[model samples]
Target: MHRFNAYRIFEKEGQVSARLVELGIDDLDPGEVLIRNSHSSVNYKDALAATGTGRVVRRFPVIGGVDVAGVVVTSGDTRFWEGEAVLVTGYGMGVEHDGGYAEYSRVPADWVVPLPLEMSSADAMAIGTAGFTAALAIMRMEQNGLKPANGPVVVVGASGGVGSVAVDLLAGLGYEVTAISGKDDQHEYMRHLGASQVLSRHTLEMGKKPLEKTIWAGAVDPVGGEMLAWLTRTMKQDGTIASCGLAAGIELHTTVMPFILRGISLLGIDSVQCPMALRRSVWERLASDMRPRHLKEMTRTIHFEQLPETFDALLKGAVKGRVVVEIQA
Candidate 1:
C-alpha cells in the first residue's frame, strides 16, 4: 500500500497531541506479518495513550490502539499464511511500538494469533484486549477453584469494557453475577448482560474494616483501589479475586487479614505478556463456551475517524461496553 490513514500521537515541547495522518508502509515497525487491518478497539489504555492523559505510550509518534483483528496480507513466518484472519494484542503493542490504529499493521508473527474459526474479525475486535483481560481474569479464578456452584461472582466497574465483558461471560457460564457500577443509568443495561443483580458503587463503601461480612465467592475486579480492598474484606473464605485494571485508582489500602485469615487469593491479571499457549486458549474459550451472548448489545462500532471523540468518551467514563473501530469500513 502506498498510503493509509493512521492516528499518531506525538509529544513535543512537553505537549502531547494526536492527529490522523496519511503514511506509507515504511512508517510501520519491522515485523514478520503484515496485516490489512480490519478492526481495532478503544481500550482504557488506548484512551490514555491517544489523549496523553497518562504515560501509556513509552514511544512518541506511534499509532494509538492496543488491539487489532484483521486479515494477514503477508507473513514471513510459516506459522501464519497469507489471507488468514488474525488478531494481535499486548506485548508492547500500542505502548512501546506502533499499533493498530491504522489501515495496516505490521507485527511479529509470534504476536499474531490466528482468529478462532467461530469468530469474525469484528467479533474478535469486539472482544479485544479488554475482553481478553477479563477472560484471563476469569480463567485464573477458575484455576484457583472458582465455580458457579460456589456462589455469586461480583464484577467491579461493571459498565466499562473489561467489567462489562466479565459480567457477560460469567453470567453466560451460569454464574450468578452481581455488577457494581457508578453509572446508575446503566443498571438495567447491566442486568440485560446477565447480571442477576446490580449494585451501585456506593454499596462497596462498607467501611474500611480489615474484614467484613463474607458475601461473594469470587470476583472479577477491574476497578482496583478501594473497591478491590472492599472485595478482599467481603469475600468468602478461599475466595479468589482477579485484580485487573485500576479504573478507580491504583493504590490499595488494606490489611493482609483477608489473605492470612481467610485464605483469600488475589490473582493479578496481566494480559500484555501472557503466554502464547494461554493467549490462544483464552481466545478459543472466548469463541466457544465463554462467548458473550450479548456481544452485539455490548459493543458499539465506529469508523476510524471517530477515535478522537471516542477517546474523550472513554476517558470521561461515558462509553458503555466495548468500542470497536472499523479500520476497513
Candidate 2:
C-alpha cells in the first residue's frame, strides 16, 4: 500500500455545494490495478462535475476527472504487469465512481486499456476523452457513408477539444475540412490543424428560412441546439451530421425537411456506453491512421494543484485546446 495526494469533492445530501479536500490513496475505490496516474485531461463532463452543474456525478465525494493515462504500480490481473503503461476513459469514470484527478487511482483491470504503440502516457492523456470522442465520431461517420471523398466536411465548435482533434485527424486523412468557430483568435490555430476554411459561428445563426443553401457533405458537431439544427438544414443531400455535444443547448428545433426532403442522416455520437467491440476498433484506428500529427503542439499540460483555477476557466469557455493534468511527480 502507498499514500498519495488527491483532489476530492465531498457533497452532502440536500446540498448543492461541494467541499474540496486533498486526501490519500487509502480513500480510492476498490479495483485490481493501482495506478500511479501520470496524466489526465479535462472535458466538458469534467467541468460539469467540477462545478456541480450537470448531472455528471450521482455519487458523493467523487474524484472528477474523466480521462487518465499512467503506469501501473501494482496489478492483480496478468494482462497488466506492474510498470506497464495504460489509459482509461468512459465506463462511469468521474460519475458513478472515483476517477483520474487523483495522483493514484485503483481501477478495475477490465477498464484499463494498454497504451498504444504509437502513444506515450502523456500523449494518450493529451488526446484524452475529447480526442477519443472525436475519433469515434469520424468512425461512425465512415460507417454511415461519410467517406473521405464525400465532398467537404465541416466541424462545429472547431477550436474546442473535440473539434481541434477532429480537424487534425480528418485533415490528416486528406479530407477537405471547414471549421466553424466563435473564436477568431483560433483562426490560425485551426488552419494549422488543416482546416481549409474557418466560418464564424454568427454566420450560421437561426434565420427565417427552414432551409438555406446546402453546403458541406458531412459534419462533426460538438455544439448542439441551433448549431446542430442549422447544420442539418445546410448539409448536402444524403449528408451525415455526427452530433456529439450540447455546449449550446439540448433542444433541437429543426424541421423534417432536412431528413425527409434531402435524405440527410443525423448520426448521434455517444462516447459513453459505446460497445466494447466498437471502442476497441476506434482505439486501434486512433493508434494507426487516425492519429493526429501535431499532438505535442496541441497539448496544454498543468499540474494537479492548478486544477481549480483551470477548471473555472474551462467552465467559462476561456480555455483552448486540451488541458492535460500531471498527477504524479
Give me the candidate number with maximum TM-score. 1
Candidate 2, residues 1-329: lDDT per residue as tens digits? 54566666666664534434566667889899988888899898888887777766878778878888889999999989998988898887887778998888888988888888778888888888899999999988888888877799999998889999999999998999999998888889999999999988866555657787888899999889888988888888899999999999999998899899889999898887788778777888888998888787787888866787887887777787888898865
CA lDDT of every candidate: 0.92, 0.85
Cα misplacement distance, residue 83 of candidate 2 (Å): 2.0
TM-score of 1: 0.98
Which portions of model 2 show Cα errors greater than 4 Å? 13-22
lDDT of 2 at 287: 86
Q: Which candidate ranks first by lDDT, i.e. highest?
A: 1
Per-residue lDDT of 263 in model 2 = 92
Instruction: Give the clashing pairs for model 1.
Output: none
Instruction: Mark the 10 consecutive residues where model 1 has the least summed lDDT.
Output: 201-210
| Model 2 TM-score (2 dp) | 0.95
